[model samples]
Target: MDRGTVGSAQSGRLLVEVREEGSSAVVTPAGELDHHTADVLREPLEDCLEKGYARLVVDCSRLEFCDSTGLNVLLGARLKAEAAGGGVHLAGMQPVVARVFEITGAEAVFTVHETLDAALAD
Candidate 1:
């Protein structure tokens, strides 16, 4: 995956960073997320689910854009997380990134928080 550390992926357009906070795994994808960069985010999310850390928190404060491929990655992660008796939480979405969710009704499927701290608290 060319990651500098475990559970992280970085490319020219995207950087997906993963960290554990309590029982939750917080994945922060910073930069554009499109067809080319989707796997950078997808792999770690699936890794967390496979490891049984089903409570996934996506810190999207730094994310700038998301295309259908990127959205699909998240939706897939959410379903897997739920199947494991946990769920995906999205926090700190920028207006551009949040609009994609709002228009596609993806936001309703996720627990949206205004900040990363709120997501962690929940």
Candidate 2:
């Protein structure tokens, strides 16, 4: 699979990497995903959908933080993917990040996995 970076690294807040795993597009976003950096993740995710990659796995093992903005982006992606007869899976969330999903009841909305491999298996 070809690996590449998405978005400018100059922001120093987030780094998004895009790669393909099997039939799924895996997006790994590191650093803080807040209002300011949410777009960093959005663009690549949208690209995956546009490319007809309906099965998307977000490998968040390196993700340090996530706020409402980040959640919104995930939710939007989920909706879009579902409409396209695909689905978005979130994997390896940090405790703090997982807490955000739990607090907002988004855990029920998304398919959460303990590892990227597990998500890919699904």
Off by over 4 Å in 2: 1-10
Model 1 spans with C-alpha error above 4 angstroms: 1-6
Candidate that scores best on lDDT: 1
Clashes of each: 0, 0
**Displacement of the residue 65 alpha carbon in candidate 2, Å:** 0.6
Tens-digit lDDT track of model 1 for 1-122: 12223367998999999988888899999999999999999999999899888899999999999988999999999999999999999999999999999999999999999999999898
State which candidate has the highest TM-score: 1
- Locate the minimum summed-lDDT window of 10 residues in model 2: 2-11
Model 2 lDDT per residue over 1-88, tens place:
5444433332479998888787788999999999999888999899999989888899999999999999999999999999999999
How accurate locally is residue 69 in candidate 1, as Cα lDDT from 0 to 100?
96
What is the clash count of model 1? 0
Relative to the true structure, candidate 1 has a C-alpha RMSD (angstroms) of 4.0
